[model samples]
Target: MESLSTKSQLDMARNVHDMGSINKMREAIASGDETVLQEAAQQFEAIFVQMMLKSMRKAQDALADENSPFNSQQVKFYRDMHDQQLATDLTSGGGLGLADVIVKQLGQTEDSYTPASVIRSDGDLSSLNRNRVYNVAEAQDIALSSQSIRSPSAQKD
Candidate 1:
């Protein structure tokens, strides 16, 4: 029953003019289901993709020949419909990875976020050298030397 609502919401989500999707989004939030939250993120990403397509179309139209039949308003309407469907299809197929990022960010509790720059993609942690032991004596000698340098009275000629 909830899955049907999610599927319908995903469908309606493709059309920006559909107000029911907003209510559906509220329901998803109220339900607090992980699956519904994921769907909501995808739905949002699909809408974002549709808007990007619309912006690209607008940019293309700026250089278009107004006198040509191809640039007609009717053509634009159908093109927008096509773009909406395309956005939906693209989102269903893992999207631009924006939906995944969205879910990952929102799913984290508070202390679990590893900053983007700190996340290594190479699958190598050798650079961190977590197993290396510190030489406490060497560290103490260095710290004392620095302290003596700062307080010249402690430095012997």
Candidate 2:
């Protein structure tokens, strides 16, 4: 289990928000009038595809952020694993397949989420709940601990 750093947690927060929005957009298309649905279907798929691509970029951003302790090599490894999983899923006719890949890699699926980022009744991005994502005692507390082990000067100020 890999503990999420602040940045990684934030990324998860954003990912959840984005995914919720995407799903809502999808649902709206489904519930809308026939002409609206038809028009939205094409635009929605394009936007969803872009959302998937953006998520990949955001994942890398989280791993590379200054607050993260993970090096490029480590991030690359995780990213590659996710990419491969996504590719396999896509090849199997799965759409986007990001949520599954994230779930498989992180063991935290987006749907029915309680911990991490919060969402609205319609599943839109709501205020983030801090307690849900990171805690010192969690098995996956990869984030650098608040307790310092090195000299004060040696740590980042």
User: Pick by TM-score: which candidate is best?
Assistant: 1
Residue 61 lDDT, candidate 1, scale 0-100: 98
> What is candidate 1's TM-score against the reference?
0.57
Worst 10 residues of 2 by lDDT: 1-10
Model 2 regions more than 4 Å off:
1-55, 58-64, 94-157
Best candidate (score: lDDT): 1
- TM-scores for all predictions: 0.57, 0.21
